[model samples]
Target chain A: MKLLEYQAKQRFAAAGIPVPPGRLARTPEEAAAAARELGRIAVKAQVPIGGRGKAGGIAVVDTPEEAQREAARILAMDIRGYPVRSVWCETGLSIDAELYLGITLDRDRRRLVIIFSAAGGMEIEQVAEEAPERIAKLWPDPFAGPQPFEIRRLAFAGLKHAPELHDRVPKLVSSLVGLTSRLYEVATSLDALTCEINPLVLTPEGNLVAADGKLEIDENADSRHKDIAEELARDETGDDGRSGDDPFEVEARKRGLTYVHLDGDIGCIGNGAGLTMNTLDLVKQHGGEPADFLDIGGGANAERVHNALEMVLLDPKVRGVFINIFGGITRGDEVARGIIAARDELHITKPLVVRMTGTMEEEGRKLLEEAGIVPAKTATGAAETIVQLTRAGSA
Target chain B: MSVLVDRSSRVLIQGITGREGSFHTAQMRAFGTNIVAGVSPGKGGTDQEGVPIFDTVADAVAATGADVSGIFVPPAFAADAIMESAAAGIELTVCITELIPVQDMIRAREFVIRSGHQLLGANCPGIVTPGQCKVGIIPNHINTPGPVGIVGRSGTLTYEVIQGLGQGGMGQTTSVGIGGDPVMGLSFPDVLQRFADDSETRAVVLIGEIGGSDEENAAAWIRGTGFDKPVVAFISGRTAPPGKRMGHAGAIISGNTGSAQSKLDALTAAGADIADTIEDVVRLTAVRLGTQPR
Candidate 1:
């Protein structure tokens, strides 16, 4: 759900907020063309993570040729584990003064805060660490809009030789707040976890612009946002880098489940997202690498369970499959039935470790045993079993 | 004799027609909750689990005299749903819907505060007075009515701790999941205040995760208020690396202040009896509350 900097700026421009003219380029040729259009530009790598400049992702190039060269360098690079897929070609701006503006959820106060500073182009974290006094934060009145006077004072304190920019700063702040509120609305509407615009910049020409943007929509809320849901579905269908043999894995993906192909050889499946993640962490903690994060949700029937086991065991790297169920709404007996059904249908060659809790756990365990699968009594026991299986080279 | 709700509390379920709403509603009813009315626009005049269905919260409240509402509206309309309940004069509104936009929550929270209405969560497990009323989706089987008041942010972790309490034969007065969302309706301090004043609640069990300053703030308040009741605390995600965001949308520890260690230190410094594990929480709570072994 994270929009690249260029995309966010485009959104800001669409909302009537003045943003520097920018073009996104996936290739060197596109970068050259973008640079030609912008004349003098800053070629910046388009990575979702921050600290791009310090990581040498941003370069100021005077000509199209230089812009293309910088774009090539950036696109070929991986700044912070995330590979730079494209470069943002933006028009270079005259600096009368630099200032920062952003809006984010303030969890402690249980409100949204507008953060502003005269020192733009610096990370907000750096500002907080070094010159905390320079930064001015304002909690906007939800009923009455952001106060101009409060923003003006903040801008005046953060910027140098920008008295002329003072009047426009508050106006821009109001607009930024409005944009943030709108973006938040869109994000929530789409079930996004976060939508952020960092280093909302102000230029010498008294123009305000969003320098960077990051939006991460919540996957849980995807069912409500049809547009995002369709996009996700399309993304899944179009992704075919890994194919064949892993039919169970393919099936799981088709069913809208996240199935990561890991080398650690332990296939981990669970009912809840939190439990799955914790199980993965515990597996890692216990010297076992989880092959996948497969959450069958709270209502995984017999068919889904069979499909899940097939998917996990299909991974060539998987030597053992671990099924952990903390049954609350979904009874343990249902999970047990699924395991039995899947075992009957699928050729699961790998050793299976099942840890079932809550209602009908004993019944579930009995069913698993009847199906020739020994169930682990505890989560720790299951995790240990996976580790032992992988270490002993026994499937 | 619970903090927020008990057997006599008449509950109304909003968004009762939806899948999640209906499922949890059935669970609550089975757990012996006084679920008098169900509300869902246009689905009104229909019945859910034999509970009388109403078009609006007002109608549900008017007919059933239900003062407490458990909301299951989706994230998109959750804010509006909360506002409706608040406007309808519901004294306490428990919103179980997760992933509500921060803006919507801000507006909903402001409106609730302005109108003098109390709201619980936009992403929470709801409140449960063990052996009495179960509102929201906290599993009823894991809990039992006792003398301890429990408050937590995470759902499963709270369940684990409560299960531990149950296993130790230490039932709870009321266990409230304040929710793991960034902008939740109720804070730890807010719930702790209620627990402090409640005569039936002899002790408090606080379950916190790394992220927001809610724990630190609660620690300060607890220190300042001088609540005589013993508090046993367990902070989860301690092994969670700094800057690594958890599954909860609100679960992110950005700086040093919001780290698990810092929160744990704060709680410890505030005189809260610390428990390393779920079982340890049970043992500490029993010892602190003078609940001897059966």
Candidate 2:
């Protein structure tokens, strides 16, 4: 649900948080065209990740020819596994100060927090680390949002270290008050878990403009904001999607399964998030690395189990599959039948190990045994068995 | 003697006519929970499995005197169900629905809090008191009433401890899944406080995962409150890669937080024994209790 930079800027603009004029360019020619129009533009990769500049995913070009060249290079670049499908060409800003502003959920407090910092831009890395007091946080009343008075105080606290801008304190405070409030509005309206404008530039002309932005919507809230979700969906597969998105994941998403790809040989599946994670940890503990984290999410049947197995084995790196089910709502027999069915129908030669427990597991255990698939006694035991099985197969 | 639920606690099903609601209703009833009423918006005045169905939580509460509500409504409608239960003055509302939008939860949680009631799990396995009452989907017959109080983030893992520990004759007073969702009701400290006050409970087994600061917060609460019970803590997701977006928040919220090591270190510093594996969780809790792992 992480929106790319251009998309986030659009939302920011709509919310009255001023952003530099930008055009999303899908090709080198588009970027060139954008440079011609915007004049002295910055071509940035449209990946939903940070540190793009360090990764060489961003380039500033004064000429349309240079813009095309940089865009071509960036568009072909793999910035942290996300293939750059497009670039954001924005009109360059004047020499000015950069500030950090963000709105996100403070999970511990169960409230929205406004993060403001006068120390922003590239020169200061780890501002929060090097100078913790510089970054001021204000938790808005969930029912009321941020008040103007509180926002001004936050602005003052965050600006305490930046004494260079002492003269325009009043104007800065007013700008921050308006910007943060609008960002909060965008956060609430979009069900944004994170709405950030890093290096919100204060221009030489005294105007505040968001230089870079990020907006990640809450996954659970997407159903309520279907339009937003679909409109700004991550180009997960690099074409009409974000890069680094595994085809298995795309398939899983389509089938309504929970799966995350990992770089290992043991394909892990479990009934719950904790159990699934434990499955991965157990594999690592047992001298085997996990290939993926897959949660069947309860009420598993033959079809779902088959789908999970297929999805896991789709990775050629997957040497073996281990399913750890501490069944509560999902029955053991159904899980066993699914495993057996997957084994038979998919013709999976990869060693499959299952540890099924809780709620009619005996029946499921009997079915697996009958199918010549032995169910392990414990999750640790299952991990041990799978690791051994995969080792033997690989060796 | 159970901290949250017992035989005498009257329970109502919010989405009584729905598939999950009807199915789990039977399950809960079979576990000896006193099923008093059901709330289905349009199916009022009808009875499903002999439990009278009311149009709203208020009407159901009025007729059946149900203090505890189990919500099985879909994610889209779950928040409304929670607020409905809260508004109707239900003392404890346990929502078993998962994936309810966080915004919806924030509002529901807010309403529940402002109304002076407790809401557990919009995406959680409901609380269960062994041999007395089972409110949500924790399997029945997994226990024989005893001394330990279990609070966990995972529903199935909670069942694991119950099956292993409880069946091994280390029965629990109650096992509550606070839920794995980052934004959830009844955190570790909140539940720990309950277990602290419960006279029947002697020890607690905390099953935590690698997200949010709940475990760290629980650790702090344990140390700060000087809680006397022997707490055997186990955390999952030791092998998880920190989620990119969530990791950013974690980095900003606190320095190098929301990892297994951080939670473990915090808990260890707070005088809680850590279990490396689920089996270790059972073995360590048994050792602390001066019993053999069964």
Q: Give Cα distance to truth, residue B55, candidate 2, Å.
A: 1.5
User: What RMSD does model 1 have?
Assistant: 4.6
Residue pairs in clash, model 2: A235-A241, A235-A242, A236-A241, A236-A242
Candidate 1 clashing pairs, residues 3+ apart or interchain: A1-A215, A2-A215, A118-A158, A118-A159, A192-A217, A192-A218, A193-A218
Candidate 2 runs further than 4 Å off: A122-125, A232-240, A245-251, B242-255
Q: Which portions of model 1 miss their true places by more than 4 Å? A: A81-85, A142-204, A209-322, A349-351, A359-395, B242-244, B255-258, B292-294
Candidate 2 lDDT, tens digit per residue, B184-249? 778899899999999999889999878678899999999999999999998878878866221111
* CAPRI tier of model 2: medium
Give the docking tier of candidate 1. Answer: acceptable
Q: DockQ for every model, please.
A: 0.34, 0.55
TM-score for all predictions?
0.84, 0.93
